[model samples]
Target: MRSLFTIGLIASWYASNIGVLLLNKFLLSNYGFKYPIFLTLCHMMACSLLSYIAIEWLKIAPMQRVKSRLQMMKISALGFIFCLSVVGGNISLRYLPVSFNQAVGATTPFFTAVFAVVMTSKREGWITYVTLVPVVAGVIIASGGEPLFHLFGFMMCIGATAARALKSVLQGLLLSSEGEKLNSMNLLMYMAPVAVMALFPAALYMERGVVGITIALARDDWKFLIYLLFNSALAYFVNLANFLVTKHTSPLTLQVLGNAKGAVAVVISILIFKNPVSITGMLGYSLTVAGVILYTEAKKRSM
Candidate 1:
């Protein structure tokens, strides 16, 4: 039964993740929504509200009070990183093909490895280190042959990827070090609101006097607003599933599953967007996906 629940949670996480990716691409690229930061702010707002209801009203997860000022600060710091990572990803979608974006985003494990080594002085087995090579190499190869590659988009995606990795590492360290820790639902109840607060200023500044334009566009097309609301709701589920998965399974499993999700997302993006992929790009992406699988297996063996 536990295994079944884990599988269900993983499935939900992957589905919601892919759904949001495609939906966001549709909005930002196809539908011509020009404000990534604002969209992210909307997502955070939705998540904040949903998390509150889940924790406070629905009683999904017991609320745990923060034991100290230090812990609250740590979670707030995480919220800041979360805002940046998400906004960066949404912005990159505006300028890059989802195929290339997922390919680049798959490099999160590589960044995770680097951060683990640098921050925690954690050493991995040789095979663990070896598996990351193809991950990085593949992205470099794909970048060289990408038809839709924009330098700015590539940078933003990479930044988002690294920030995500950093968050994973930091969250582990922060939560573990504390005597009392909030579970994922409770943590998000706090983090989501902070993330919304952190992102609003940036969205306002970045969107820059375009509120009238966005409001006009939304009024003209109620469907777009519907899509945005659905997208944000899916984002909330993604967060819930992410925490549940990590709680039920090991982080290593989540890491491996994430790579698989990215691969699936790339294929779906290609089919939906009819994006052209070069021979070199396909080979690179294939290699990267295979490498991530191998890395997952290697980690399993080491464990």
Candidate 2:
């Protein structure tokens, strides 16, 4: 029964992750919402509200407090980074196909390793480092083959990937102590509101009339509100499912599932969006995923 519950959690993680991605793509690309920053802000808003309800009202996870000013500052820094990653990702989806986006995203492990070594002077084994070569090369090959390649989108996606990796590395360095280290759920509870605070001003500056536009759009079509609401809900579920899966299983398991989830998302996205994909693009994505798997194995062995 416990195993079954874990399976359900894993499934929920995949579903929520994929669902959020597809919905973001639909709203931005097909539905013509085009306001990536505002959309990301909405996601953070949902996360903030849902996390509060879950932790405070429902008592889903034991509430954890920020231990000190320094810890709160660290969490705030993480929130800023989270805003960068999520906003960049949403913007990239506006220009890039979901299939291609996942291909580029698969290079995250490469960035993570680089950031880890640079930020912490932590060195993985030579074999582990070698695994990153295919990861980088695959993205390059995919870029050359992608018919719908957009330079700005590619760059934004790369930025998002690097920001994500940096956040992971910094989390280890900044909150390594027992007193400072909060569990994922509580961490999200704190980070979500901080992210919202960071994103609000930027969204106002970058997307000046997005609020008015969103309201006008919703007035014209009530379904827009429904889609926005559902999309934001899915975003929160993605984070919740992620925390639950990590709690129930090892981080290694979560990493492996994440890799598989990307591939599954790619296939499902191609089907749903009917995005044209080349053989070279598929091959590159496969290679990247293969490299990530090898990297995971090598890291496991080293540990």
Q: Each model's TM-score, in the order given?
A: 0.93, 0.98
RMSD of each: 1.9, 0.9
Superposition TM-score, candidate 2 onto the true structure: 0.98
Clashing pairs in 1: none
1-303 per-residue lDDT for model 2 (tens digits): 999999999998999999999999999999999899889999999999999899999887899998789899999999899889999999999999999999888899999998888878999889999999999989999998898999999999999999999898889999999889888788888999999888888889988899999999999999999999999999999988998898899899999999999999999999999999999988888999999999999999998
Which is the leading candidate under lDDT?
2
| Model 1: per-residue Cα lDDT over 30-146, one tens digit each | 998888988898899999999988888887778788888988899999889988899999999999999999998888889999999999999899999999999999999999889
Give the local distance difference test score of model 1: 0.88
In order of listing, the candidates' clash counts read 0, 0
Name the candidate that leads on TM-score: 2
User: Candidate 1 — which residues are off by over 4 angstroms?
Assistant: 1-9, 246-250
